[model samples]
Target: MTIRVVVADDQALVRTGFRMIIDARDDLEVVGEAADGEQAIRLVRRTSPDVVLMDVRMPVVDGIEATRRIVADGAAARVLVLTTWDIDEHVLGALRAGASGFLLKDIRPTELVDAIRGTARGELPLAPSVTRRMLDRLLRTAPRMSAPDGLESLSQRETEVLTLVGQALSNAEIARELALSEATVKNHVSAVLRKLGLRDRVQAVVAAYDCGLVRPRRP
Candidate 1:
């Protein structure tokens, strides 16, 4: 399926550059552009892009808040935060606000295209270290009253699959580790997602961390 994307950046150059890269891909297309955070939200609402490439710094609203609002509005769009480094201040906020992943601006064009496509399919671009860091940040902050409701519905085996996902393990790796068939792993992943009402693997990871199924810090 074609993945519709919204590029939200303050600099005209950045937006233009991304548009060129995305539109060049047969599987990806840039459906709209936003020069500021407010415009980003508006455009996303109007266009219903499958994924949003959000700049951390914007004129009126920051990408973090824009992501927060978009998520709160119950949009199915995935937000990929753009930052200078993988671990920026807004990176944590955006993830906490339900972003799929954060990518540095200096990433190669090929990787950016791949990451956008990944995000469109509910995948994350985060490394294990970034996932650990974001989970640590979440642990340090005030605990929330809830996790994404429905984790309670997961079976013991499904919960095991989700914990591995939170740790950034791939399907085959999880299958090998769990001594289960690859097909079984895929089914478990689907069940976990359905039980948690999450859109993708990234959200599943986030839910796993918040629910204390995975430790935020490595031992």
Candidate 2:
């Protein structure tokens, strides 16, 4: 199946570049282009793309708000946020706003394509560097509070899986850590998301930090 996508960036060149790359793939199509967040949202509603390539620094509505609105409106299109900076508040904001993945602008073309596909597949495609930075930021900034509603519903194994996920372990790594098959780990991760009402693993990581399930490392 061809994955429809909307390229949203304030810079015309960036949008064009992304469009060309995405359109070059047989399984990917650029259905729309937007120069700002509001336009991105409108395009998403009209085209119902499988994924949106959102720039966090766009003018007008801005990508984070656009992502929040899209998710709130129950749009099926998953958001893949692109930004220049790796560790920053905007990245966290995008995550909280329901982005399915985050990638730096310097990411290779092939990696960006893979990220879009992964997001469409309901996987959290965060860059490893971004993931580590995001977790560190969360530890410093996110409030240490009670678990979000529905966390207690998780089985013991599910809770274990969530902890591992929060630590930025991939499904295969989680499987290795727990001595289970990768498929089993994926199932547990899915269950954890469902039980926690999380949009994706990004949110799961936030929840892990919020609830103290994963502790910050000592200096």
RMSD to true structure for each model, in Å: 2.6, 2.1
Cα lDDT for residue 209, candidate 1: 72
Per-residue lDDT tens digits for candidate 2, residues 97-216, read 788777888888998888888888877675644575555854676556567899879899998998988887788888999999998998899888887878787778878887788876
lDDT of 1 by residue, 1-219 (tens): 999999999999999999999999899999999999999999988999999999989999999899999998889899998988654666767877878887888889998998887777666665555555655655555454367778778889998999998877778889999999999999999999888877677777777777877766643
Output candidate 2 Cα RMSD: 2.1
Q: Against the unseen true structure, what C-alpha lDDT does each candidate score?
A: 0.83, 0.84
Give the poorly placed runs of model 2, Cα more than 4 Å off.
Answer: 126-130, 137-146, 216-219
User: Top lDDT: which candidate number?
Assistant: 2
